[model samples]
Target: MKRFITGQHVSLWRLTKRVTAQNPMMKYLIKKIPPYPTPVEFWVSNVAHVTDETGFKGILKSEQFRAPKSELSWWDLKIKKEEIRAAEKNYMKRNFSNKAKEPNEQKPFLETFTTSPLFQLKKSRYGNYRFTFPLAELMEWYKEQNCGGKEPVLRVYGTVTYKQQIVYTVLIHSPEDSERFGEYPLLEASEWVRYQDGKIIWKAQAICETHRYQFVSGEVQRLKTHLFYVWDQVSLVFHLPNRTKPCKAVKIPRQRLIEALEACKLDRKIDLLRYKSPKNKEERFFEAKMKVSELKRELEEEVKEEKSEAENDIKMEVDP
Candidate 1:
């Protein structure tokens, strides 16, 4: 009879345990526990590409600024207008000379114009666009403004042509340096193409309004003059037809470019590795708790199961 009672008790306990384990509440509790995070998943969650989310937009927005006109009494709008006229006059002269030249003579003039300080000609088989600026004259203007205590203003006045059609006038200026900063019109460009072969081949062109920016003081502030200096030297070398090797266009001096990058807070460590999510210490702690809580719940459930099994065995023996 005792052996029979032990067998019945064992069968009843097994049935009860199966029913309890299959209960909706038990299943819900089990699902409430999250799975352990793998090391690869954790690492991936922390780092991201520079182009992710607002990455590109954020960088661009940081570089943009529009100062009020009241703040720029120093920059006379008339000067910018005059610079445009000067560039226009030079363009007219070059157009006439270019039309009169034969194919052989044209190459010399084209090469000379590409390096001219008073003018810049970007030519390809597609078409040619000219950008003209008198750096010496602009420097004199800068001195007259007594911008020594202030940042230098850059004004780009040029034109673009495509398929033998005159596209539009290209004008851009540093926003803070303009009289009407928030309201002024300027050309907006994408990445500044690194100068190649003493020429710029335009990938595309558009009629848009935007501004160019520069730092108040640093290598970036003086970058314009430095690039122009290099351009002047390269242009002079190419002017000679008897030149042995082709003059490669260098955008900026190596040392100066390095110094400029170091001086820029954005360009220095921007491309380096950086954390992506959990942007703060508090969030990191929360993630740790999440992982720990999952492990803790699992351990507690395992202990509870072992205790239940042991107690069931003891009760079955005691009942018999």
Candidate 2:
């Protein structure tokens, strides 16, 4: 009888365990606990109890805490649904708010322009000149052509102006070769303009002789008048009327005139060139002319000095 009674007690304990496992409330409680040890289950149970007593289904689903479905009444479930909707709306609002700022953000213009296909084409078409012969070959050819056997050192000074504004200036030096016939360094100048479509495009190109030539070994003869123009398969000469012959002066483009003005400023002192007699027009003109004459004289002196210095440098290099 004692053994039977012990068996019955054990059976009763097993039945109770099974019933608890099946109970919805117990299962919900277990579900509320995270895989890791956390306070989420305790908080959910407290919220569920409060919501049940207050008859507020919405309170259970509030951002403060979320109750298990088995513990929440029908009304509390409705509140949870509303909370989910509100959270979704808030997320959407945040996402859209971030997107709105992008249009106003500054972007890199140069990087985009350089990557564009049109820009690439423009660069390829005008950026470099194709020469048939190499410099060494050109030098040999010059020797064979009886071109004075003087090695020519060409110095090219380039200035680019756009819309009456000086944009760029560069000095390129190339030593002439006599080996290759008709071989010269390719010269290319390109100007970029931005379009309404946010695309950067090339506007115009002005090419000129790069002043690089091959001469035979002998006296270095400077070309009498260096040619300046836009050359590509054809040459367009830029004519500057003699400043001394004002009446015969060709209309100077505004861009060229501006460059000339800038050059003049750098050529001489500004204060000495300014007119002091503002009250008398004739006197101002006369004074201005005299100032110009003085500036000219100074320029000539400076040129002479430069020439002398260059000669001295060459002498030193040769002597040393």
Candidate 3:
């Protein structure tokens, strides 16, 4: 016999099925989506929170719905185990590849000294300067001098250059060594005694004159003077080193030219955006006008609200 089911009947069937799906026995029988493939992304992303294969296995084994080990075939267990191992390997590779690439053994300090620079003082074309000195050197020097125990660190004398201005700086290096290095040299002390107390408290031996080199600058300052003094003793003098040699002119390299071109292109793009065509300029002006108009409207609304609030207060007072 031919029997046709109405739409109402079909709806009722679906409703009944949905209601029965809530039943504990039906829950297991209802075909569930096969467990989603364990995402490779899960191993790498939010690494601090993700569980390892052992932890995951423990979770699966603890689940109430999981089948018993005995129920599963040996091949299934082997496959799952292999999958877990593969996942672990992927996790290890992702996390440890960089670590593996890192140098495990460091070369000796003396070996490194020949290869690496102890200090670097770089001056750029724009008059910016950068200086790098090893902190370990100062500590090592202090240790060698025995500044910590018995012996003190006296006045520290070091040459410091600021923007190509070389100054023979004498500072109280350490309280321990202060008395030793602070003592003025015999010649300077005699000169200081001859001069008035306030007239010359500190005598600085100037090897280079201020007004000597008016036109030359930077490393070229070396050309202005041929005489070099060490502790008031003439160490180098008399002979001119490069009297006939011409000064080298600064040339922009090809790479610098390419970089400049790129910079020019970017500046041109910005200029075009700001003032390319009358239409774009007009559009910008229109946007600015709209913003101003909006601000004016907001201010007017605020004023009206304030007036209304005052009126309301007055009305309330009158009613009272």
Candidate 4:
């Protein structure tokens, strides 16, 4: 009959069997099971933790009740070893094949230069070169040039690698030299090795413009002229006109009046009415009074005309 046991019962059975097997006389009393034991307390603890933390409850369903014992023969071990060896060999072969596709052989700096867009044969006049200098040597040269000051300057570094090994020292140059003569220059210190396959083909130097003084100057001047033009336009738009006196009371449309004010403000021609030295306050007052008097006389004449017209109309009506 197949027997079912609780997890705790399994642990107790395994522990009892282990104790029995340790004694030669009790060994026969304990039967060896094909599948080996489970630790019930461990499972119970894990389950309790998972439940309390609200984590990984699915693991309980998949938990193994017993561990399987390995029953490998000598021949099985030999076959397994052979399989591992084959896997390793295949992995190595694949790695070598990939390396072959992209050969690790480092080409000479000149050969690399020839492949660059800036240094093609057709662009010979455009300055093309290569450099081979270790960092130490490059730093020495930099110090010699007094360019080690604490200013931000462009720097170039390059390396030549073959088979994943750096076979040549890199060269370093100031940004100016790098720009004029391709990044790699022909002129480099003697300590570095030049390589064709691993040889230096050629090196040249050219000047690079670090600061464009003329271009910057022109840009600044252009901006200044633009600002001046804008200021002139604003001045013309917002200028207030000289007011001799608050404008006379007139029933003019608001829009028309605003437009007139804006026009007067923008008008640059000097306003003759705003003479620097008005003859005197008295003169100015007298002139203003005379103007008012003339206006009053005109108004009186207009009233008289209207009155005469009304009188004539009354007479005509009586006669009729």
- Candidate 4: residue 99 Cα off by (Å): 99
TM-score of each: 0.17, 0.17, 0.15, 0.16
Candidate 2 vs candidate 4: which has greater lDDT? Answer: 2
**Cα RMSD for candidates in order:** 39.1, 42.7, 41.0, 46.1
lDDT of 2 by residue, 1-320 (tens): 00111101111113224334444323322222111100010000000011111212232223121223321111000012233233323422443344322323412121111121111211211111111122233333333332345543221122322111122221111233223312322123222221122111222222111222211221123344443221111111111112322311112232222222111111111122232333443343344345445545666777799999999999999995
lDDT of 4 by residue, 1-320 (tens): 11222111112223344433334323322433221111100000000000100111121233211111221100000012232233323323443344222223421111211121121212111111111122233233333442333211221122321111121222323344345436333323322222222122212111010111111211211122111000000000001112324211112232222221100111122122333342543453345345434545665677799999999999999995
Clashes of each: 1, 24, 5, 16
RMSD of candidate 4 to the truth, in angstroms, is: 46.1
Instruction: Compose the digit string of candidate 1's lDDT tens values, residues 184-285.
Output: 223233122112222221221110111122222111121222221111010100111112243111122222221211101112211222435534434433
lDDT string for model 3 (1-320, tens) is 11222111111113225434434423322332221111221111000001222322332344211112222100000012233334434433554454322222311111111110111111111111111112232223333333442322222133322221222222213344345445523223232111122111222222121122211111112133332211110000001112223311112232222221100011211121322333443353445345434545665677799999999999999995
Better of 2 and 3 by TM-score: 2
Q: Relative to the true structure, how large is the alpha-carbon lDDT of every model?
A: 0.25, 0.24, 0.25, 0.23
Candidate 4 local lDDT, residue 300: 69
Error of 2 at 18 (Å): 99
What lDDT, from 0 to 1, does candidate 2 have?
0.24
